[model samples]
Target: MASFHFELVSPEKMLFSGDVESVVVPGADGDFQVFAGHAPVMSTLHVGVLKIAGNTNAPQRVFVRGGFADVNDSGLTILAEQAVDLAEVKSDQLMQDIRDLEEDVADAKTDAERARAQAKLEGLKALQLAVAH
Candidate 1:
């Protein structure tokens, strides 16, 4: 696969900055991938996983709350609202996050709100399952 400079930034710090072969992001509409020479685009990300594969290390999976991804002529940059390495997340913490999301689903007032919350819950569950094994 071809490579391109990629950066994943959060409020706290710059999580990853280097060349990567592929990046799969959880876009608000759906999952999409970026590679070298990809067309320029700006996208809003949803709560889900970002998979990074490259030459620097083994593939890494990151959980991002919400964010934006920008692909330009130079490279791809992801400005995440909140991001964490799935490997470092404790089971208990993940469970708490799930509980919170569940509450959001339960507290939703309208059908649209409930659907959004449910989508978030499902994404979290999928991430949890991926982390478990």
Candidate 2:
């Protein structure tokens, strides 16, 4: 089977770097899949689960808040604002975080503030779902 190099990186450090048969990303428009020799493209990513397949050791699942994906003949690179592996995620803590963000959203007085809070809430929701799956 064909495989491609995949790298997930955040400002802090590189999260995952390995070979995978395929990967599905939560693009801004919708979900999209990448495979070996996929056409070169770039996209803005959304907050959701990044599913990677064909790792003999284990399947990889990652939660990303938002990012940009750069794909080419060689591989795929993700530059994310925040990213976390499923195994390291804490569901209960994420729930608490969501609750806190909800409170902030409720208290937001300005439209801009509310929109910011709403975006955070959505990201938290995505994280919860990612962890669950």
Tens-place lDDT per residue, model 1, 47-93, is: 78889988556339988878899999999999998787887878897
Candidate that would win on TM-score: 2
Model 1: residue 66 alpha-carbon error in angstroms:
0.9
After aligning candidate 1 to the native by TM-score, how far in Å is the CA of 82 from where it should be?
A: 0.8
What TM-score, computed on C-alpha atoms, does each candidate reach? 0.72, 0.79
User: Could you give candidate 2's per-residue lDDT for residues 23-79 as a string of tens digits?
Assistant: 999899999999999999999998888888998653388888888998997799999
The candidate maximizing lDDT is 2
Candidates in order: C-alpha RMSD to true structure: 4.6, 2.6
Q: Which residue runs does candidate 2 get wrong by more than 4 Å? A: 56-59, 103-119
